[model samples]
Target: MAISGPSPFLRYGVRIANEAHTSLDEAAETLGLLGYAVVDSGLDADQLEALRARFNAIHAANHASTDVERLRAIGEVDLLRCPLADDPLFLALASNPRILELCERLMGAGFILNQQNGIVNPAGAKTYSQSAYHRDLPYQHFVSTRPLAINALFCLDPFTLDNGATFVIPASHKQEAFPSDPVIAAQAKQIAAPAGSFLVLDCMVYHCGGTNRSAADRRAVNHVYTIAMMRQQIDLPAYLGDDFSTDPKIRQLLGFNHPTARSVEEFISQRKAK
Candidate 1:
């Protein structure tokens, strides 16, 4: 059987959650129990469907074939340019107000819009070693002792275990590092969200994109926001930095107003401070 207890990752936030209510309260509660929270929104189903179409079109053209290579031994690929943000249909998701406030509370007062990615998992892609059991922390250039990293997934289509939905090990963020021998497969009770429903995960949790055994492609928009220390997996500040502060949606993610100093060099400074 799998070992179980309060995940070391969620210890602090969960404490803060039990003390409050509302979305803020829920966030604290997630920290206490699950190590993350899904803030509800009215970004709506239509918006998500439209965004999906926009992504599928771009996804088709972005490649000569829909066949994209993935590290399937670990199960999935984190594709950075999915074109959802560029599509007008995705405007609401790119700029949701509730998510912005949550970013400020969890990441920091000067958080950064770390990365915006689109994930595509093909049918029958292998699982297990593909993603391996890991926390989202290993790749950080800058980080905090306190958890300040957050990733949100916009399920463009319904997410299910049979076809690859993102999976997590309850609250696993508290671990200093990821498990090398974590042999359990992703829980079947995965994040099966409706279209437009967004699920957020604390970067500390052990997670990976599950295998897609069905023919339909499993797609999602992954938007991650972080404290100043973490280097984004994408060229964030360069692409979105100038308009980040003034862009109301982006601003909420930043906890910061101006992001003129964003660069890899900035990441080094952040790493040093920690």
Candidate 2:
């Protein structure tokens, strides 16, 4: 007997149809296999422009604020936390139908937006907090049959090699602890994508921002979606207040319905209300 082609044992692993067409299909297949995927964001020129403008305004405002300066002192530079609170545009991006669909596929229904952050890798910075490899669900050390959380990072600028595209360790989400330094160097992959693309990752995957050797800054908005049981990075409902969105789906995504009860009476009231 002669085995001329690839090993049949390859069939033992996760397999999808060769004809898997559509961005969602590709994203699902790759996320299942490599712990990450990139798909077009489908934002037209005008939308992109508006998002960029709003992001810049927020960045300027935050940069001068005392809170942001405090954060910068600790090496967390150009990181905009909860941008959705400042502008509705970020919320719209976070609730993109395709992104939500992908999150539903991986995390099942009732997933909530754990965090939304606008990150900038400044030009010629020595290092930033995100330069260190860490999971979105930091400090956790366990693998799940399915993803507990996922990150959809919308690239606002071309993610070129010189501009500091994100670096990811392929299939690292399956491991409980970070691999050794040598293993990381061998397996690390830099993800270079266009401006209107979303880099989706399993939150368990170890990843970090690359250095921006270019003269321009690299900008992105990151949204982390997790199962409803997990606490949000910020109490989004409280932060955004009641006027943010009237749509139930949008409200739920912002964790309006998942707030913790402060007392036994409140718990009973919530259950009754439900």
lDDT of each: 0.62, 0.89
> Which residue ranges in model 2 land beyond 4 Å of their true spot?
1-19
The TM-scores, one per candidate, come to 0.71, 0.91
Number of backbone collisions per candidate: 16, 0
Tens-place lDDT per residue, model 2, 1-274, is 2234555554556665343456787788789899999988889989999999999999888777757667878876678889888888898999999999999989899999999999999899867668889999999999999999999999999898888899999999999989999999899999999997899999999999999998988899999999999999889988888887899999999999888999999999999998
In model 1, the Cα lDDT at residue 149 comes to 76
Model 1 TM-score (2 dp): 0.71
- For model 2, what is the C-alpha lDDT against the true structure? 0.89
lDDT of 1 at 245: 46
Q: Which candidate has the highest TM-score of all?
A: 2
Model 2: lDDT of residue 258: 86
